[model samples]
Structure formats: C-alpha cells, structure tokens
Target: MALTREPPAATVDPSNPNIVRWEDIGLTLIHNFITEEEEAAMIEAFHAQDPQKEGKRRISQHFGYHFDYTTFGASETHLTPVPSYITNFLPRLPIQTYLPDQFTVQYYPPGTGIPPHVDTHSMFDEALYSLSFGSAVPMQFRMSGPNDARKMRLPKRSVQRKSDENTEPASSPATAEQTQANAQAQDAEEQSACWEILLPPRSLLLMTGPSRYGYTHAIRPRKTDVIDGKTVPRQGRYSITMRTVRRGDEIGCNCAYPGVCDARIREEMAARRDGAI
Candidate 1:
C-alpha cells in the first residue's frame, strides 16, 4: 500500500485511523518517547508512588501501581513538557490530554496482564493514549462481528487459539437454536473493537477508532515457568493509560475522580457553595 502521507500533519476524525505498524499504519510516532534514563526515573516514580500506599487514590483492576493526584489534570500537558524530542511528531493527531482523573499505572508483571475489555465510556469517541517503557509485550487484537456472548471463560486449550479464530469455546455442544444463542453469546463478547500491538519501552500505544468499537485488546504479559509448575507467573510490565470519558447524559462531571461522585453532585455542590456568599 502506498503511504497516504497524512500531511505529516495529524488530523482528527469521528473515524480515526488505528495504526498496527508504523511502516503500514500511516500514523507518525511522537518520537522515541523516553530515554533510558527517563524511563528509569519514571519506573522509579511508579514503584515509589504506589496508590496502595498513597491515600489519594485507590487500586484498580487495571493492574500495576497507579497514582491519581488531585491536580493531575490542571497541569499544562502540551508545549512539549518533556522537550520536542518527546513531543508529538504527528501534531494533527488528537492532542492527548491527562484530564483531571486519577492517574493509573498498570504494571503487568511478566505473565500478569489485563484481559480483553472495552473502555467504559457512554458518549463521544475517546482514545487510550499510553506510554510504555522497559521490555516489550505482545498486545492481541480481536474483532467483534455480528453475534454476541458477553461472558464466557476459556480453558487452557482455548487460550492457545490464534488471534483470528472465530469459534467460541462453550462448555458444552449446542443444537441449531442453541448454537445461535451461543453465537450471540460469542458475538456479544466480541462486540467491542480491539487491536493489540507490542509496545516496547520508550514507545507509545494509542487505541481508538475500531479499537474502541469493533474490538477489545489485551496485553499478553510475558510469562515464565513458575516454581509451582502448574501456573506460569507474569513478569514486570507497566503502562500508563491516559484517556477521556463520555457520560451518556445531558450533564456529566468531567472530574477524573470516577467513583466518588456524579456530575449532579458536583452541580449541587457548586450551587450550595455559591449561595453561601
């Protein structure tokens, strides 16, 4: 395919292009995101700034350690804070924001990794902008076709299936109608968009477009033989997923703090405070 030469300038879209490989995907990279020294510093900060130990934020299923500072969003994110070298090479792309939400650093220790899941946003197309450092992990991509199955666990045999395989692993066999139900089940599970790529250290991974709709991507953590032998333990992996949120309502709170309160509460709080004067 000829490179469309996307203006070497980033462009926004209701439909944004998801790049699987730079040589083919057409999206320009931001740069070698971090130097070895910088990576070391951030990794040190990640481990030192533990959410479990810190009281400001809570630990999440996203894995690894995370830091959700109260003022994270208010900071001036652009202007090449880390220097032009780390600034975006594709300026036309959506200017990544570190909105007012709590910061989360997902650590995939070796074999430990996040399963395939869609982001939980109700409105407006958003993006998952991630900066990776240290080592490389293969992210898996799967497409969601017409049928649906939202919940089904996989056994060891199914875990080895290729990323393109379409059959669902049901606990038992099914008849025609039953098969339809199973297909629906599988489709529901596969409905969300997904695409995965290995993000080596000092690299960035942006998930949007079909990645947000047609599929859910997963980072297959690096695994190794464990002492128990029956299980393979994961190695150390950390990724920072910064994103925007869409609330499917006329009104919503933009605060990064997710579980504490809804937009209504914020409005009510503002009203009460204003009346005090």
Candidate 2:
C-alpha cells in the first residue's frame, strides 16, 4: 500500500516579533492599516471611474512611467501625475525609500478569482504593497522553484498558527535524492496542499525579499470562504496594488530574479560581467 502524507498547514512565523507570518516567507501584514474613511475614499475614487475604461478585472494607472497592458511592456506614454491623496499617504507609512510610480486596482465580485502569478520582476521594483478593502477574502500563494511547491492560504480576519507542540515544523534541508523524492511527492500532493492566512478588511500586506521572487499568489474562484468552520459569502472586494516601476539605465535593474527580467538586458549584463562581449 502507498503511504499517504498529510499536506502541511500554515504556521505563524515564530521568528517575527510583529504580526503573524507564513514560515520564512517575507510577508508582513498590518491590520487596520487604513481608517474606514480612507478605505471609503479610495473605493469611492474607484467607483467614480468608468469601469469599462480599463477593462473587466481592474483599472491601471501610471505615475512616473506607464505600462502597456497589451504588450506587457513599458510604454512611452505621458506620465500621469500622482494625486495629492497618494502623496499625502506616503509619509504615513514607515517605508522611508518606497515610492510607487505605478498602481493597479482590481475589483473582484462573487465567483471571481485570479490565477497564481508573481508580479513581473524586471517591470517593477523589489517591494510591492497591496491594500485590501471591502469584504474579506482568502489569497493563495505557492512557491514555484525547485518544484518544492508549498501551498498556502490567506483567510479573512485574524489567524495564527498553533504552538510548536501541536504543530509539525518545516523539514530540514534534504539531500539530492531525498529532495527529488520530496518534489515528486509534493507535486502529487499539491492539489490538496495549502496554508491558510487570515486577512482582515482594510489591512496592508507587504511582499518583499524571497516572498516577492520565490512565490506565486492567486485567489481561487469561489462564492464563499470557509474559516473556522464558518462560511463567509463573497462580497465586492477591492484590491489596490502599488508598485514602483523599474526604469531604464540607472532606474532599471540587474537583479537575481531573471525569470521576470528582460531577456535582452539580462543577456547583455551577463555578457558584460563575463567579458564575453
């Protein structure tokens, strides 16, 4: 008989002194990061715009630089000036050097969800921030490299992992053979694998470091979310994703995240580094 293994559960970051975390993933959450009024104002701004203007899932705008949605490339379009509301809000956060030059606000009604994807690396800076408003929903993340693929979930409201005695800790690094075996096992188990995270309304989630490069995030299509055995029906949910554009030359990148970087530029940099060209 084949042995069946249980999928891993989401755990609270024991190492982080702040809000709960998912193992070593570089995710930070701040509950009630925005006031009810602020949330309302942002939503109102969204409502004020023509929904058809940007298309179905979301509306996007560029501040210092524009991104062409169709071609998925940086556009030469005129820069849209950042509004006072955004300018005023920047100083309120602890991020001293972070400034967003691009923004995307997505609306999700019932029965809607996004496929898992990491924000393109070369197109945007390292840190990406998102603010959630409206009703609460769960967001899913899965690590893609090395086929290690661990699944996790972010539920609505607050959530915490249980004490060490009651939970299984992450496994130690494996040998080459063991790693290959584990990868095969995980691939077969992935359909049922996921860790749950509780996200409250009006919370701010920051993705940086390994979390930004190593994981793909998505939301599953469903009408309701089950948390603690309670069913929470989906309502209108709005997510505002803010990122800084990676400009050309000095403002551009030469980062390790080659998966999302421009192939031409990356090749040129690599050639230069190796003195091959």
Candidate 3:
C-alpha cells in the first residue's frame, strides 16, 4: 500500500457546460463525448471480435489485462494490447496524469443489466471512465450498506409516447440553464436511499473519489426507462470502461475509505485477530 507514485487529481471543473456534476458523490457526466461516427466504429470493432459462446447473458471482452470476477483481482501478466479504436480515444478523456492500460468492453442487450458492486480498489487506480454508446440507460447509485446487496428488478410497464393523448410530453434537450436548474431540483428531492441518472448515447461518465470507492452502481433490468416522467425505449448498449492497473509493489490500494478499501480492511482484520490471540 506504499505510495508508488503521486495520486492523480479527481477534481472536475464545475464550469464545463457539457459536464453534469453531482459533486456530493464525485460523479460527472459529459454529454456528447464522442462523435456519432466514432461510436459506430467502436461498436463495429466490438462486433468484429469473436463473440464468447458461454451462454452468458451479457457479452464482454478484455484488453491489456483479464480481470477475474471471482477474486476481484487482475492478473499480473498482460493480455492483448488495447486496440487502436479504444486507445485513440483515451487521449481525449479528461484523465491526464496516467493513461489507462486496461479496459473492458461490454455489450448489454435490452432487459439485461449488471448487479450492484464496486470496482475492486486494490486492482486499479483512481479515476475510472466509462464511455457509453448505441443506447441510453439509467444507472442507479446508492451508498454501500451492511446488508447483502440485491440485484435491482423493476416491474415491466408499458411505455407510451408523449404524443399519445393524455400522456406527458417527452423530455427535450435542455439548455445549460435548464439542465442546471433541473439538476438542482433533483438534488433537493433525492435522498441518501438512491439516486438515478440517465446516461445518454455517446456520453462519458467519470467516477472518482467517493463515487469510485464508497458507493455501488447498477442498472435495473427493463426494456425501457422512465425519464422525465416519459417512457424511453431501450436499445443495445456498448460501454468501454478503462482503468489504470496497479502493479508491482504498489498492488495494494491505500485510500481514505478504509472501510471500503480491500487492502486496508484486510490489514485491520488481521491486526485485530492477532491482538486477540
């Protein structure tokens, strides 16, 4: 857990018009982070890769490093280098101190979603970025608790277009002022239970600090999402998550949230057991 290098800054500028900052949780969303053509190319590249035939609900591929889900650990050995399609876009991301060497590309079909969990702190560095494209989805975030985390499942309901009689109008792209106003309103209404945010197609989501370490994010399984009181249909979504791998003597993570930091928690437990003996 010793310092291998200076930690990268996790701060985001509030003045950036494209950024929607939930400062309280250290989450930021950047709209239109990539061009439409770029998104298409990435999606095509993902398809070109041989698909996994394990009958898994979601399809995923890893580059640079293969992450083991059971252990929540990354292998020290390197895999295939990150393809040019993904590496080319890394420079444009906000992260400046260190470029990510590991990335995972996932394809989510309609009605399929991931369970709530945090990225293992000891495995990667701070500042994780996920670029989403091909469809829009709503991600739910909640503070970690002692109880066993459950997969979120919402009842499937029929979604009607706003133009239909007696239905509310669909949400339109808001001006910067309106977006800020809406975010402020939601801030007041949302409590510690959970907060939901829409991830539009071609948007980039940045998670660092508390958001990256202390909370769990998940997507509810559903064919459609209700946004702004209107129903929006879901489509296949492709997300590219990039992270800097922690290697060598710095493999253990040292962070402020010891309760959540895997390395720190293990050390604390071992020390307590030794003292009792």
Candidate 4:
C-alpha cells in the first residue's frame, strides 16, 4: 500500500504542533503498516517462547521491562534484555526516538475483551504503541463523561496516534453539581466527538495526546463485531504492547493538559469550576 500521506497543510492544527486533526480529535491511522510475512514471522517467534498465563484470560510475556499487568506499573521491576526482533524493529518506526523500552505480548482467545480504561497516567510516557497479529479486531474508543458516551472503532492493519490536547485520562466520579451540569450540557457539542479506525492484522497503534488521556478504549466482550452492517466473528488475537516507563517517584507534573495535570489543579483550585473549558 502507498504511504498514508501527512494531512494537507490546510488540515494541520496550528495550536498543536504535533498533530494533524480531523474534526476536534488528533489521530492518524496508517493502513498496512506491516506485511503478512512479517506478521507471520512474529507469530512464529512468539510461539517459540514459553508465554506465561496472565490471570485466567490472557497469556503474555514481557521484555526489556517487566510490567505489573494488574497495576500497569514498571518502576520497580528489573530491566531485562528485549528480544532482537522487537529492538530491531523499534528503530524502523517513524517515531524512532519514542521507541519503546518495554513490550508485552498478550494472547486473547475468542470472546475475550479488554474493559474500557485509559493506560495509567504518570506511570508511562505519553506515547503508547501496540502491534497486532493473529487476528483482526475492532477496538472501540468511547469518551468518558456523565452524559451519553459516543463511540469509535479501530480497524485492523493500521497505526493510530493520540495527540496532545486529548491525552488526559477519563474523569473521575462526578459530584452532584457536576451531574446536574452534565445533564444540562447534553447538546450536540457536548456529545463527545468519537473516532473509529479499522486496524487490520499486522497493524500498529501509537496513542498519545488527548486520545491517549481523555478517552477510554476497550474491546467489547463478544464473539462478533458489527462493522459496516456486517458481523465479523472474533478469532484468537495477539497484541504486542510497547511502552516507555516513567522514572522516579510520583510528583506533580508540569504538562500543559489541565484535565490530567495535578500542578494545574493546585495552582488554580479556587478559580476552576465545572465545565470551565
């Protein structure tokens, strides 16, 4: 497939130096990021290793840095050597400098799905990357809020990015005042802008910015996914998640995203209000 060209100059967001926006969200999905032969080679390599069972639903293996699957933390784990295949491929990616230091291979059987949630903030760097193999699945993204949540789907065989303004994690439980305000704010604009990308087999996803922090992404638990009015059955799936761990003890971050930054909150406690944005 031809390279998915960068967005035309007119579509680039002046306010966000890092992203090319479509509507209010900044995400780019590069179709056919990997070849079938390469994907097959990865699967073969994975099968050659002894993968550890994660809880009861997933079998996985970690390299470079061991991550606590339940807590999604890696600060204390000892760093180990990653497989040559992963390290060799990392530098070939477009965002080579953001290359991952840790990767996990997760195997999910049919009917299994990941719950809706954002990757834990502060524990990992801004960019989250995933490589798909074995099967194709539609990953869903739903905006988190008190009002009706909108949905988006990720197609297989593509790479997606989450840009800066939308990197905050989903909001916590709302107070009574916020609930009331959310009820009142249920207009067209309030409807969370949603996006869907078809991630084919051998796809890659790099999530950053708001799409990484602001919305929640999950895979619905079922045997089939409805796409374009056609039902597609789930198959055995494998996902290789790569992330760069954040170092040091937790402290106030100075990032510009007020939605998820504690420093911004402490600095403007009294001035902030519900729906201030």
Candidate 5:
C-alpha cells in the first residue's frame, strides 16, 4: 500500500524566539482559511500567464513577477480581505493587531528571486507573510545594505527609503529627534543575520517582528538545497501574500487582474455564504 503523506498543517503560531519559528508575536492558525480550488486556480493562471520577469536584482518592483489584491481585486471575503490564505489567520495568531492591510502575489521562475531588501511603508509594519505554491525554491533571508545588495530602489526619504546609497543611516537625518527617530526607524537595516530556507509549494511563511523589521531578506544565488540528493533547478512558482493594509479608495477601487477578474465584489456577505470567494 502506498503511504500518503499529509500536508503540513497550516500553522500561524508566534515565530520561535530561539530561532524565529512563527511564535514571536502570538500568531496561530485560526483555520486553514483557503481551499484547494482557490489555490489551484491561482497557480494555474499564474503559470499559464508567465508574466514577464524584470529579472533578479530588480529592487524597484517585484523581482520575478507581481500581482496583488489592489491590482488583481481580492476584496470579496472578510477577515481583512486579500483572500484568507494569508491574512485572515492573523487575528488569532500571537501577532498583535498592528497588521498590514495588504496582500500581494509574487512569482519566481528559474533563476529569479528578490535581492536582499526590507519591505517598509507607513501602512506596512515590519512583517512580511508569504504563501508559496506551484514549485519549490530557496528564499535567502539576509541583511543587505550597499555592501550586501548591489541594486536598490528605495523611493522615499520617509520610512520607505531603504537603500545603502550616499545616505548613511546616521547622516540621513538632522535634529536629535530626527536622529533618534531615524535610528529607531532603521533598526532593521542594521541587522547582519540571515536564514536560507526552501519555500516549498503549498507552504506559508509569516515574517514578523525582527524577521520583518529586524533584518533584510533576499533570494540568495541559485543553488541546489540537497533534499533527497536530486539537484532541483529553480522552477516557476506562485504565492498568495495576505496582509492587512489601511483601507484604500474602497469605492473607486475594482478588481484588475489582466488575467482573470473572478469579480463578485460589493455583494453583502449575508446575501451569499457560498464560499466561492
């Protein structure tokens, strides 16, 4: 009889402090949150489309390919939208309320992954959660500045500008308050530790506290992570990045996937509990 291996129970516990598991900020899985149908559909479309990848080292935007609730229109279900696979479980998890109101999909094909970088924005906290699908790839979590990552695209002088350019962390600000604020703000930029892990398909990675805000994470150079001794080159992959973003132009906004709309928005939840979303 062929033994069947069950999928890793979708987990959302606080990241481990000793090594940063998933229990640092009180995150536990409320429910699996997403269905096989939804996951398969998204993966199928993403692979079929094969969005043009800007390539590795592109820090201005998504390195491989990009799609998200804002651009794709994912405000149908509750628990803060962006689909339940990534964000809905946060409320029950150890992670405190400071959640991001956003969720994005990232596609990484062979030889493609984000360079070492930190995701910062007023609307986004220090954490980044990822749900991978389609294929397996190793995501290199690292601390990169000018010496670390060669290319960067930090666009603002505010919290978002995160580059090791002409501006040093200390010289970036002026007054003492500004310095303290900058130091406090750039706490994650100064980190040096990094972890490299293979994000398998149908798996979830929630980065919080320091992992999100403490240090930079990157897709390290392409290499084989000796699994069962079979060298696995990178393959096309997809992810459902769920998070909480401050409500946007709720009314004017609409679903905008160049691929598929799956539009069923604006209908009240009470009217339809079919769970098609």
Candidate 6:
C-alpha cells in the first residue's frame, strides 16, 4: 500500500488558474486570494486591535474563543465575535458549507518563526485555512517520525496485567524482526517527503485530510529564504489562521490518522485498561 494518498480531484477547480494543488499532501495554495488594498486594510485592522505599541518579535490575538497554549484546548465559551473586516472575505473562501468561527492573527518579524506543530485534532475540524499578508515566507511540512507511523498502523490490544501474573512475550522473534523492518522502511519514506512551500503576500493556503492530520508545519527562523537558487530577504509578516471549532458529545476524534489524534489515543488507552481516562 502507498504511504501517501492523493487528495480528491474536485478539491481544486480545473479552470481556476490561481489554484496550485499539492495533491499528495492535500494542500492547495490560492495565489492572490486577497487584493493588495484589502491586505493593507487587514493589517491596519490588526494594528488597531494590538495592545502593545512597542515592537515585538511575535504578537498574536485570538477571536471567537481564547486558545490555551499550555493545555492545547479552546475555551468552551465564545469570546468576542470575529471582526467584520475579517468576515468580509469569508464569501471568497473555498469552503462555503460553513464559515469559520475561530481565528488567530499573528505577527512575525524578520528572523522569527513558529515551531513545527500539528493542530490538536479534537479541538478543531479537518479543514484549516490561513491568509498571509505583509510578506512571503517558506513554510515547511514534514511527515511524522517512524515511531508515530508504526503506532498508527498497529492495533492497540494490550490490556492491563496484574503484577503477579506471568505472561509470555508480546511477539515472537520473527514478528519483532518484521516490525523493525517496517519501521526502517517508514523512516526512509518520510525522510524523502519533506516539502517547503512559499506562501506569498495576499495568498491563502488550505490544508485538509492528510496535510492537516498527518504532518507538522513550521517556518524556520531566518532572515532570508532561498528558492530556486535565488535568495529572498524576509520581511515582517502577518497571518490570519481560521478554523471551525468542533463541538458535540462525540467520544473522540475519529479521523483516519489515529496516532496523531489525542482524543483517539486517550480513548484507546482507556479501553485497554477497561476504565475511564
């Protein structure tokens, strides 16, 4: 079986010349998603809401819900509504079935960047969108390590055992050897799949399916980026990341990538112990 799957063909419009699809990773970049005038206005709006007048390497604000970074969870109560300036562009977004309720505006100065991370699976829906303005930067996406891949592929069947019980080994030598071989193969596959996409000013990026669940995205800290053998200096940039908050009585996230889903992992561990987690 292939390690990566192609995104649905219908995700991008065939006649739309602005869409660039990275099908294997389920990412679409729409060039010039916002006009230059709109980008400037959005930046002005962000500054109007900024509490600090002094220069900061990074500044961020959240709307609709406050995100707790320590717990990686969103507040249950809704905060201030998303501003009209931001909502005005909703009609142009590719997603139309529903609009995003949560968004964060972040500012990054030159030589600063965010660490690689995957959004909490249980906290938000599958589709994630970000609008970039003020500057262009290279965003890197990487597949999870082999250990995570192994966990995703293997079934969770181990149960809690009594200390006094004498149990046989979990697997025979041949089985262990096969598992090691699989891990090595997975590591090779992931190592070669790293991608660096250039996110330009006034562009929008859409991430879904595998790209949202199976990979981590980040921007390396640097003053400049090299693309196609040409060096480009970095500038101050602002990004608006929008997402739909997930709510319901559903037990946990049932996404295809269980290894990376915190809710699913917790549920499985609880099942193994026959107790609540």
Model 3 worst lDDT run, 10 consecutive residues: 148-157
lDDT of each: 0.44, 0.61, 0.71, 0.61, 0.46, 0.75
Candidate 3 lDDT over residue span 1-277, tens digit each = 1112222233546677777777766788899999999998988888889555234367889998876554566766648788988878778888777578778889888877865667778878888888899899988776665421111111212322113211222443447686576555433423335666788999999898888987777787888888788998877888988888887786787766665567866686688889952
Which RMSD values do the candidates have, in order?
Answer: 13.7, 11.8, 14.1, 10.3, 15.5, 8.8
Model 4 stretches astray by more than 4 angstroms: 1-24, 51-56, 146-195, 249-277
Error of 1 at 176 (Å): 17
Candidate 5 C-alpha RMSD relative to the actual structure: 15.5
Tens-place lDDT per residue, model 2, 1-277, is 1214232334544664345444466777767777898888877776676444233354444554565564344566756676564666677554657677776666776667765666666667777888788878777766544333221211111113323211223454446686567556754644444444556788777888767776666777888888777998877778767787666763455655554444434566689899999
TM-score of model 2 (CA atoms) = 0.67
- Kindly give the number of clashing pairs for every candidate: 35, 7, 0, 23, 27, 0
Q: Which candidate is the best by lDDT?
A: 6
Candidates 2 and 5, the one with greater lDDT: 2
**Local accuracy of candidate 4 as per-residue lDDT tens digits, 1-277:** 1112232222444664433334444444444567788777777787788554333366778887888654456746567688776776776565766677778888888878875566655667777887887888877665554332211111111112433221222444557676565455643323344334556687776677766666566676788876677999888888888887777664335553445333454445545554444
Which parts of model 2 are misplaced by more than 4 Å?
1-18, 21-23, 51-64, 70-74, 146-193, 250-277
Cα lDDT tens digits, model 1, 70-188, are 32221233221222222323343345452313234555545566555444333223455666665665565565333312231222243334442233355554467876776666645
TM-scores of the models, in the order given: 0.47, 0.67, 0.74, 0.65, 0.47, 0.76
| Model 5 alpha-carbon drift over 4 Å, by segment | 1-37, 45-100, 143-193, 221-225, 246-277
RMSD of 4: 10.3
Q: What is candidate 6's CA lDDT for residue 117?
A: 64
Q: What is the descending lDDT order?
A: 6, 3, 2, 4, 5, 1
Q: What is the lDDT of residue 116 in candidate 4?
A: 59
